[model samples]
Target: MKQRLEADKMDSAQTVSAFVQTTRDKVSVINNKLQRLLDGYLDQLIDQETYKQEKNKLVSSKKSLEENLLTLERTQTGWIEPFSKWIDQAENLPAVAECGTLLEQKSAAKLLFGSNLQLSASEASGTAQSPWDFLQETKNSFKNSEIFADCAILEPKVGLEPTTCGLRYRCSTR
Candidate 1:
């Protein structure tokens, strides 16, 4: 089950990377064309006014493209990859089956059923802290509830417990 979750996370990362790469490639092509256009204008092949207007457009487009590339890089490298790694390493807890609707326990139940689990936004900090610890902390935040769910065990940290005490709660709201 843990292996399957890891594989799913890997698949998501690949999909995100592929999309970012495609965007960057398209921007590169546009930037290249703009550079060539500016070069031709500067050589007096095009009139001064025409050259100025065209160059301005190209420069503006290049700036926006560069900004987009930076944003995508941050999203992919700075967030998704690290979060995926963390999720793969977080600890798992036992799931509790309650009478409430399944949607209430979707995330926790998914963990129990071996379905893919997505790390919550709280667990996605840019830091390199242990994922299992983060998940355990998150689970503890909701420990007052009645719904119980199972989580996977991430590799133990040095001098830490083999598995973290996450939760076993039942929620009344479905």
Candidate 2:
């Protein structure tokens, strides 16, 4: 599985690399043409009006190609490892919350809270990110609602087994 993942990553990068090469080649061609155009204008081989028009078109093309190349380069797969590590850490957050060490809890908090993490008054508090924040909002809304106030365990009417209740939530590897 690891080998396949590595191969897939390489394949994805290969496609981007191929396109980057093509774009670089196009840019090089444009630059060469531009230099020749300048030479023509300087040598009086081309009129000023014609030189200006051609230069404008080539400059526009070069700028666009450069921008595209920059974007493609920025999208490289260098972030995959760190993101996978983060996912692993995130999946273990429930365990961290349950019985992990203080350092582990701090790490988990920072992962969930991002830059909003704050340590004050002997307590940690912050705005959570994404699904966590959504989960908090859902929990608060439910806790404040009258419909679920008297209810703790949600029992099925006829068949299903009762599951553990409360706002207790856990993160899963999936």
Candidate 3:
């Protein structure tokens, strides 16, 4: 039975990995199209600078999508790693038109409360509130916001840096 369960989990992981790969391929194709469009505009084929600017946005969007696909693949494998991988990807992307990120939402909410938000592993052992509760509350906030409703990841606070004790909230108008 244990062997069967392990095999089932492995199969699930394989399925998720395949899905991630397919999603990555789609995002890559879109990114390539955007790149080509941008190149054409730069070469004066498109004529409108605005068109080039819009196409350039695909660079970051494609990158974030790729990162998210990778993160999902990791999650499907039963790993509970920190969300920094996705956050790092977003941070590296160019901020263009409105697009949201899940990591950003959690980080923004964490920032609003405090920066050093950490879910105590020991909480899982007792009747303490689950860490996900905080996230849920933050998600509620995102739904009601007028501007910068998308979530954003924040840089972890170091010694003497202004930080919150719980999840952080960072609202950006840009």
lDDT of each: 0.56, 0.76, 0.57
Q: Give candidate 3 misplaced runs (Cα > 4 Å).
A: 79-174
Candidate 2 local distance difference test against the native: 0.76
- Tens-place lDDT digits, model 3, residues 88-115: 3334433411354867655544533345
Arrange candidates, best lDDT first: 2, 3, 1
Which digits, one per residue and each the tens of the lDDT, describe model 1 over residues 1-174?
Answer: 346456766786787788778877877887887778778877868887887787788678778867876776666545545655544433323332354356645554444434544468654222223434455565676577554243322232323334333532222121
Which ten-residue region of model 1 has the weakest summed lDDT? Answer: 165-174
Candidate whose lDDT is highest:
2
Which candidate wins on TM-score?
A: 2
Q: What is the lDDT of residue 122 in candidate 1?
A: 55
Per-model TM-score, in order, reads 0.42, 0.53, 0.39
